[model samples]
Target: MFDKIYDVIVVGAGHAGGEAAAAAANMGSSTLLITMNLQNIGQMSCNPAMGGIAKGQIVREIDALGGYSGIISDETAIQFKMLNKSKGPAMWSPRVQSDRMRFSEEWRLKLERTPNLDFYQEMVGGIVVEDGKIVGVKTSLGLTARGKTVVLTNGTFLNGLIHIGDKQFGGGRAGERASTGITKELTDLGFETGRMKTGTPPRVDGRSLDFSKMEVQPGDVDPEKFSYSSSTKPLTKQRDCHLSYTSPQVHEMLKEGFDRSPMFNGSIKSIGPRYCPSIEDKINRFADKDRHQLFVEPEGWNTVEYYINGFSTSLPEDIQFRALREVAGFEQVKFFRPGYAIEYDYFPPTQLKHTLETKLVSGLFFAGQINGTTGYEEAASQGLMAGINAALLVQEKDPFILKRNEAYIGVLVDDLITKGTEEPYRMFTSRAEYRTLLRQDNADFRLTPKGYDLGLASEERLREMEIKQKKSDAFVGFFTNTSVPPEVLNPILESKDSALVTQSDKMIRPFSRPNITMDDMRKIETVEAFIRENELDTEVLQQAEIQIKYAGYIEKEKNNAEKLNRLEGIKIPENFDYTRLKSLSYEATEKLSKIRPVTVSQASRISGVSPNDISVLLVYMGR
Candidate 1:
C-alpha cells in the first residue's frame, strides 16, 4: 500500500540517492527515498573522507549549485586540508577526513528536516514501466509506490556478491545482504547489464598500533571547509594520520594466499577499478618493488578505529592478519572489519543520455556506483544534476545539461554518456582539457546562475557572486588603464625577479611577466585603496588573478568550445541505416548503430567511429 503519486522516487540512500532526494525535494518536488536500511544513510562505505584531487572540485561545484554534499562533509569532518597548495589554482582541491558515524547521522538529520522529502525503509526490487517509460517501483515487501520519475541509485546492492579468499557469498557490504529481482527484471526488459567489482580495506583498532614508529601526517594548520554555506567554519584543531610502508615480509606473506584469492584465482569474473587496485594486485604487478605505502587514517575524532588504507584485499583472514603484522608499526594490529571485494550489477553508462536518464526508458535515471562511478563526489554531483533535470522534466522545462567546457561535473557526465567507461571512472585535473578556466575557486561564478534559475541556489549567493564579479572586472580594467611608472614599480618588480617595466603598461601583460601580484597593482593608489576597503577573500582574489593572467588561454578555450558546440547542435537521425552507407567502416557502422548517437559530436566520440565515417555522415546530413 502506497501513495497515489510522488513527483520523484529515489531508490537506495547512499551518496547519490541521498543527494537526489534532497535536491528534488529542495526544488519543490514531492520526493520519496527508499532504502533497505535508513540507519546507514550516507555511509562512508569505502573511506572515511570526502573531496580529494579532482573529486574535491566536484564537491565544491555541487555545493555552489546548492547541493548537500559539501555541507554534510563540513559538518562531520574531523580533519580538513587543502590539497596542492603549492600548485596552480586549477589544481587546488579541499579535502576532509570525516567521522564515519557523524557523517551518516548528519545526513539522516538533514534529510529528516528537508521539506517535500519522505523516507521509506524498503528495498526496491523492480521498476513499474508502461509503454517504455518508468512509472514507479516495486519494493521487496510487494509494496508499489508510483512516481512521475524514478532515479535508481542501487549502489553495490543489485545482485551483489562479496568475496574473501576462496569463500564467496551474496552481500552488498560486510554486514548487509544483497538486493535481488531488479537485475533480472531489467534484463528481461532488454536492458543490458554488466558486473563491476570494488573493494575496501580492513578497519583496524587504533589502540592496537604503535604510533611511535610511524611518520605523522597532520592536517593543514589553516584548514578550509568544503561548503559555501554560512553554517560552516574553518577547522581549528586537526587529527594526525600516520604513514607506514609495507615490508618485504608483508609481500611474502600475502603471496601465500594468491592461489585462493578470488580476484587472481578466477573465482571473480567482474572487472574492478584499475586505479585503486588491491594490495595483492599491486604486489603481483610490481613484483620487484620492495615496498608499497599505506596511510593509517583515523575513522573519527571519538572512535578508536582506523582505516588501513592501501591494504584492500580479499585474502583469508589469517593471511591478512599475518601480512598486516609484517608491516612497520603494525605488530599488534586488530581489525574492526575484514577487507573484501564486492561484485554488483551495473548497466554500462553507454545506455544513458546526457541528462542521466536511460535512453531505453523515459523518466528512468541512474546514479552513483550503479552507473559504474566509484567516488562519493562523483555520485553526489551526478545526483544533483540528475535531480535538477528530473524536476525540470516534470515541469515541462528544457533539460539542464552542463557542457564539457562548463565544469568538471560536466566533463564527468559527458564522458560517461558519450565514450562510456569499461572500468570505474574517477575524476582528475588531467581529465579536464580547460582546467585553467575551470578552477575550484570559481565554482560559484561558473554554476550559481544556473542553480539560481533552478531554485537551488539562494539569492544571497547570487548577489555576492555578482558583486565579486563586478569588483574583479573593475579592478582588472583599472590595472590595464592605469599603469605604474618604471621608477615607482621597478624595485618591487625586481624583488620578484620580474623584468623592470620601461613604461606604463598593464600589470598582467607579458611585459610584467612572472611576478605580477596585488602589490604590484598598489603602484596605482586608487587600486591599492580599493583593495584595502574591499579586502576580498583569497579565493576571489585568486580567481580574479587567474582570469587576468590567463585571459588569452581562456578566450582560446571558449572559442574552441564554441566550435565543438556547433557539432553538438547538429542532430543525427536515429536508426538511420548506418549499414547501408558504404563509405563507413564495418566497425563504425556496428558502433553507430548500437550507440545511435544524437549528435555528430557524440558520433565522433564513439570508440570505433573514424573521422572518415563522420565526414560521410556529415555529407549525408547535407551539412
Candidate 2:
C-alpha cells in the first residue's frame, strides 16, 4: 500500500516512461515509475540503434534539454555515424548502433541513481480519477498508489493483440503479456481511442550468416556521439553492419505464405508505419522490383544475436526461414524467433494540449505510442516535455511550451496537437520549416537556457553553451574584420577551385565561396594564427563557418519565423465558439471547434482552416 502522495506517477517503463520519471524527479518532484518488468526498462524492442535523419536531431535536442536519451545512447553505442555528411550542416544527423543489453542496463542504472524517484513492478490496471482529475493509480495487485499527477506512456500495451501467421494472441510485445483495464477505463471517461500496428524483423543467430557475400557498412572514420555531456565516452572501435538483398526467388517464397500472412489475410486491420512497411507489403506494392535491400545489424557487443533489418513480416515461421535462406548472406540463416506484427490501442492526440495533457482530464498526460507516435526519439522527447509540464503544473508554474522555430521538439508537439496523425507519425527533416535555425549543432544554443530555467538542465550545460556561443561569435567577428592580401589568400582559393580575390579583401568575403571551408582559410598564415590565438574547438569553428557561409538564408528564415511568431502570440480564448461565426466555412468551423486551437497560428495549420479563415479571424480579433 502507498501512503504518501507522489508528485508524479509514470506508467510504463519504455523510453517515454523512463524519461518522464527522470525529468520529474530531477526537477525536485517525488516520482514513482510503475512497470510490469524492470528488466526491460529501456529495451530496444524494434532495433538496437538510436538516431537517424531527423530523429538524430531530436535526440540531440533532448540531450540539450537535459534528457538522458543521448547520454545513454552514446554510453552503449557499438557503432557511430553522422548521416547525411555530404549534405548541408542542417541535414547532418548523429546516429549510433547501441549494445542492446547495455542500453537497457544503463537506463535502469541511471534511473536508480536519480533523486526523488522510486520504482515499482506492477501492472497499472486503472487510474484513480475524481471529478475529471487524476489522483492516483490502481495496480493489478489490488493496491492503490496515490499521486498528484499521472503520465501514461503505456507503449503498445493497451489491449494489445499480436499476430504471427494465422495464429493470434493477446500480448504487448514478444513474450510479454498484454495490459488491460486502462484503455477501457479511459474510453469510458470520454476519451477517443483507435488502433495502430507496428512490427519488427526476426532476430537471427549471427554465426549462421555468411558475411563474404555481403557488403560491409562500417561506422564513420571520425565517430561523433549523441550526448554533449562528459558522462558518455566517445566510440573508438565500432562493429560493422552488412548490406544484403532479397532476390525475386526470395520474394516468391515470401509470397507463398500470403494466405497465412496476418497482414494480407485481414487479421490485422490497423495501419502500420507508412515509411517502414512490411516485406510482404513492400513486395505487394512494388511488384515490378526484383530485389529489396536488408541491413544485417548486430544486437550487441557480446551477444550472438543479429537483427535482420528490412525483412519485417508476419508470414509463417517456415515461410520466413525458407525465404531468408535465398538471400545473399543468409544462405544458411537460423532464426531466434519469427517476426510478428502487433496492433495496440492509441488515443487521438487532437484531444490533448501542446503540454500533452488531456483537455478532458486535468492532472493527467499522455505520451509516446499512446499519442500515436512511432520512433523512440519522438516518444522520448514527448516524455521529456510532458514530464516537465507535469512538474510545472504541480508547482503552480506556467506550462513549458516550445515554439516551432526554437526546437524540433516544438515542431513535433505542434504537428501532433494541430494536425492529429492518421497513421503512426515519424520525424523527418522536411517537417521543420526553420531547420537551418534548428540544426543539431545549435540545439544547446536554442534550448539550454530554457532547460536550465526549468531546473532540469544543469548549470554546467548552460556554461558550456555560453562558452561555445562566445567563441563562435568571436570567430565570426574576426573573419568580418580581418582582411587578407590576395597574395596570401589567392593560392588557397585557387587550390580549392574557387575564383582568386583580385585585391586584399575581408576574409569572410573569400570564405563564402563554394567548396571553400574553414580549413582552407586556416591554410592562410593570418587566419591560422588567429585560430591558434583564439583556441577555438572544432564545434565552435564549425558553428562560426556555417553562420558566415549561410548568413543570407539564415537571416531570411529568421524573418519568416518572426512573422509567423506574431500569429502564435495572438492567443485564442479556450472556450471560443467557432460555430457562432457564420462567415467561417462549415468545415473550418467544425475542425476549429474540434481541435480547439490555443493560438491563431495553430488554427491556421489545421487542414480544413483556410488562409482566408485566418484573415477573417485576425480582423475579428482587431489585429
Candidate 3:
C-alpha cells in the first residue's frame, strides 16, 4: 500500500480534511485521507450546527464551487433557517441545525463513495518533505505512504491538551486522543507554531431539562438549504432549540470556580476565540451584567443529549453542575459530559500563499484549525481551496485564486494570508469590503462557472447555475419594461405604508420601494401573471427582486471592485527588494519584504503599509 504514490494526501478527517479529500478526489486526484479514527470523520466537535451571519455566505460559496459541505449539510439537516432575513440581502445567511452523528456519517459515506479517494485509519506522525516539496507522510505505527502533494488539515489535534478546571488531559476532544509528532517535526523544519485554545459547552441530558421555563426558537416558515444541487432538500421537520439565561446567582456560583479555571488562573496562556468565548470568560468580562443568554440545542433527533450553546466553560465538574442547575431550563440538568478548553498548536496563516499552499514547503498545504481559524464553514472553505489548488498543481494547471471582491471565501483567504491572524479567524460580513457583491443568494452565479472550468464542479451544476442566471436576468428585464396600473398597485403600496402612485408606473418602481417585498409584488395581477408565465422558482424570484431593489448599491460596489481588481493586476516581483524603494516607509519596507505580497492591492492591505507607502511602491513600479 505504501509502494504506489498518491496525488494528494490529506491528514485529518475533520470538516476541513473531509472537504479537502472530497474536492481533491472529485477533481481527479488520487487522494488519500489519513485519520486517527475513521468513524469520527466530519465530527461537529464544537457545534452541531452549520452557518451563521457571515459564515452562511461561505457555505453557499463552497456549494457553488462544487464542495460537499453544502450537500452533506443539507442532507443531514434536522432544521434550517435563513439568518438575518430582517437585514439587507447581503446580510442574509442560511444556518442549519444538523443531526451531529448523521452529519459525520454522511460525510464519511460521501468520501467513501467518491472515486480516486481512499481512507486509512491511523495517526500521521509527520510529513515527508524532500528539498521543500512534499513526498509523503509517516504514520505513528512506523508505516509510510507516498504522495506527490500533501495537505495538513489536522484540526485541534496537534499535541492537544484539554483542560477541565485545574485538571489537564492529553486529548483533542472528549473521548478523542491528542495527535502527536507533526507539530514538533514541522517546527523543526522552520515552521512557526503557536498555541490556540477553544472550548465547547457541556452536553446535558435533554430528558432532565425543564422546557416550560425556556423560550422556544423555531425554524423559519420557509427554510432554504445550503446545497445548490437538487440532490438534497430543505428539512420539512425541525427539532426546535430552546433559549435560557444565566442569572446573577448562576454567575456567583461560577465565580467560585474561576480560581481553578485555566483561563483566569493562567494555566492556559493561549488565546481562544474572542467572538465565541467560554461562559466563565463571558461572566468575567461582562461582570456588571445580571444575565447572559443560552441556547439549548439537541445533539440529534434520536438522542436525548442537548448541547449548551452559549454556556461554554472549563470550570470544575461540581461547579459546572451547581451553576448550570441555577439556570431556568437546566434546573435538574444531568450531564452527558463536561465542557473543556483545549490548547492546540496552530500555524499562523501568513506563511501560506493565496492557494493555501505553504511558501516554505512546496506541494504542502494547510487548512482548518491548524491554520488558526475557528468554525466549520471557514475551515471547509479553506480545505476546498487547498484541495483545488493541490490538484491543479499536480495537473499542471493554473492556480485558482479568488479576489476580495469575488467572494466571501476570497475575503477569508486574503485576510488569513495578508493579515495573519494571531487569534482564531472567523468570517463575518463586516470583514468583507465588498459584501454587497458576495451575497448568499448568488454564490452559484458568482462561482459555479469557475468551478466547472476547473473540472471541480459537475456539468449539471454549471448548467443549473446558467439557467438560473438566465431566467433571473430575463425576469429582471421583464420588471424593468413592464408597468402596472394605479388600481392594481396603489392599494398594495398603501398597505405597505409606501407612497402610492397616482398614475401608472413601472412594476419595478413599486417593487424596489422599501417595505415592498417579493411577496407583496406577487399580489399585482401583471407581476403574478408574468411570474406564472415564466415558471420561475422562489430562488429566481428572490434573486431578481434583490437585483432590482439594490441595483444602485450593487453597481456601486461593482465599480469599487473593478478599482481593486486593477491594483490586483499590478504584481510585485518575487524577491523584489523593498529596501531599494527609498520613499517607502521603514515599517512598510520591512512588512512588504517579509510578506512578499503577490499583488499591489494585497500589499496595500497589510497592517503597516500606509497609503503613502503604496504610492511609493506604485511610483517605484512606474505604474
Model 3 steric clash pairs = none
RMSD over all Cα atoms, model 2? 0.9
> What TM-score does prediction 2 earn?
0.99
Candidate 1 worst ten-residue window by lDDT: 506-515
How well does candidate 1 match the true structure, expressed as C-alpha RMSD? 2.0
The digit string of per-residue lDDT tens for model 3 on 60-138 reads 9999999988998898888888988889999998999999999999999988899999889999999888988889999
After superposition, candidate 1 runs with Cα above 4 Å error: 510-512, 515-528
Local distance difference test, per candidate? 0.87, 0.93, 0.92
TM-score of each: 0.96, 0.99, 0.99
Ranking by lDDT: 2, 3, 1
| Model 2 CA deviation exceeding 4 Å by range | none
**lDDT score at residue 535, model 1, on the 0-100 scale:** 75
How would you encode candidate 2's per-residue C-alpha lDDT over 177-234 as one tens digit per residue?
9999999999999999999999999999999999999999999998878887766777
Candidate 2 displacement at residue 614 in angstroms:
1.0
Candidate that would win on lDDT: 2
lDDT of 2: 0.93
What ranges in model 3 sit over 4 Å off? none
